[model samples]
Target: MTTPKTNRKSGFPAVHLLEEIAQLLAEGPRTSNELVAITGYTKVTCCTRLKQLEASGQAYRVVAQASVTWYAGRKPAADTAAIIPRQPTVRDYPVIGRRDMLVQAFFGAPRECRA
Candidate 1:
């Protein structure tokens, strides 16, 4: 069988696909299915991209449960993906008030409001 097209030095998918996947992973860890959903790519394509990411060291995978796995970069280990500082999820912020202000101070009020 032919090998998947991937960068030998970087192990990343071609530029366009890498950007797509990178956007998704930028939020946090994701499963292969999630990548497929977000990128509108086929299962095979998602799997291929993920494999390339792992090979390139841009992403890593770890077992979440029996027969299930997740992928992430920027963490200590893709296999052991965890927030090093244990921060809050985006949804944790309140509507308005002290809690909201704190969340804004901590995470900077989501991606849109900042810029």
Candidate 2:
């Protein structure tokens, strides 16, 4: 009589896959499709891993009107403030009446009709 040989590499396959998914989420939030493309895993596999992560409290899901976004940690507050305030940029300024003024300033005033 001979005992059957086991071909197991690791005990927890789900944990291993979950760790890979968590690493990806740590980089930033992502959609399931993005995970699929990045990990080269099927959509169902990615989604299953995400659900497992969510259950384990290592990740979370945000449902929007069109799609769901997954983040790598506990769900953030709805009104969380940024750790560092952002510096204002050109785009931050209002454009209501600055376009024409800026153009005229750069190019000089349009030539006036000499009567």
* Clash count per candidate: 0, 0
Native-referenced Cα lDDT, model 1: 0.66
Candidate 2 regions with alpha-carbon error over 4 angstroms:
1-15, 77-115
List model 1 lDDT by residue over 6-109, tens digit each.
Answer: 64444555547766786677677788877766666667877887777777777777775654354556336544655356666666645653346787898775
- RMSD to the true structure for each prediction, in A, is 18.9, 13.9
Which candidate has the highest lDDT of all?
A: 2
For model 2, state the Cα shift of residue 44 in Å. 0.7
lDDT for residue 89 in candidate 2, whole number 0-100: 69
lDDT of 2 by residue, 7-76 (tens): 2433334436668789989999999988877766568977998998888778989999999999988766
Clashes of 2: 0
Q: Scored by CA lDDT, what does every candidate get?
A: 0.66, 0.75
RMSD (CA, angstroms), candidate 2: 13.9
